[model samples]
Structures are given as C-alpha cells and as structure tokens.
Target: MENHFMKRSFLTLPLVIALTTSAAISQSLPPDDHQNVASLQSAADQGNSDAQLKLGIMYFNGQEVPQNEAKAAEWFQKSADQGDENAQKALKALFR
Candidate 1:
C-alpha cells in the first residue's frame, strides 16, 4: 500500500505542478483580452508555434477556454514539432 501510494504521488506531482503554474500564468492576463484569445486561436490554427504554445497553456489551465489536457497535449505536440523549445519543455513536463 505504501509503495502504491508513493508511485501515485510521484506520477501526479509533475501534473499538479504544471497545472498550478499554468493557472498562475493565466490569472495574470488582463480581463479585456478575450479578443486576444481568439487571435491566438487563429494563429495557432495557422501553425504558429508560439500561438500553439500559448493555446496549450490556456487549455491546460482552463483560462478563457475549458480545461482539456488532451487538447493541451495536442497543441504542445504541434508546437514542439515546429521546434519550439518552450512547447517541447511543456510537453515533456506534461507527459513525463
């Protein structure tokens, strides 16, 4: 039982820290930036790696959009494929 608990804690600690950090970052955004979200989404859809990273953060944090880990991972992968270092780190932290 102790080993199982330790394993679970180890597995979840990174995810918890990622979510917490993402939430803090999201909360720091301005209130009137709704349009920014749309623009970011548009850029992300257009294969802008920076936008993809931002969208991943937003989705991961449940900021302007609903929180979705799968969606976050998808966005991160796109940016990572484009050679975005931040996105690569985010993906590693998320999946590791």
Candidate 2:
C-alpha cells in the first residue's frame, strides 16, 4: 500500500504543478479585452485625451473594438482637439 501511495504521489506531482502554473499565468494576464475596452471608452467619454487616443488605436486595429475607421477618426479627432500630438498625427494619417 505504501509503494502504491508513493507511485501515485509521483504521478500527481506534475499534474499539480501544471495546474498551479496555469492558474498563475492566467492571473498574470490582462483582464478580458471587452472589459478593458469598456473602461477605456468610459475614460474617453469623460474627455481623457490619452484614453481617447488609445481607444482610437484599438478601434483602428480592431483590438477588442470593432474595426471602424469612422469611430477611430472620431476618437482621434477628440484627442487631437485636446492637443494630443500623437492623436493629431494619427488623425492626419487616417485622413490622408
């Protein structure tokens, strides 16, 4: 019985380690993409130029938000109006 227990323990060790490692990795990753985009959108709506620029980039690249040049341009324009140089450049590029 003791030998059988030892064999079982050894067999379970790797499985235990793999599960622990997976949990840790998952915890370290960023939150859900939708949640992130929603938070960014909220901030942008509140007139945060940086958030607007980031949201614009996300929309432009379809990263979380749908790919919509119109939405991206709108967000970029909002940031540009607030004197965000990056957003200004992006807006110009989008229009060009």
Name the candidate that leads on TM-score: 1
* Residue 25 of model 1, lDDT score: 69
**How would you encode candidate 1's per-residue C-alpha lDDT over 1-96 as one tens digit per residue?**
999878777876775676577567656779784347888989999999978987888888787889999999999999999998777777876775
Q: Which stretches of candidate 1 lie over 4 Å from their true place?
A: 1-35
Tens digits of lDDT, candidate 2, 28-95: 77766333767878999999997897777767666666888899889889999999877776676555
Per model, state how many residue pairs clash. 0, 0
Best lDDT goes to which candidate? 1
- Return the lDDT, model 2, position 8: 70
Extract clashing residue pairs from model 1: none
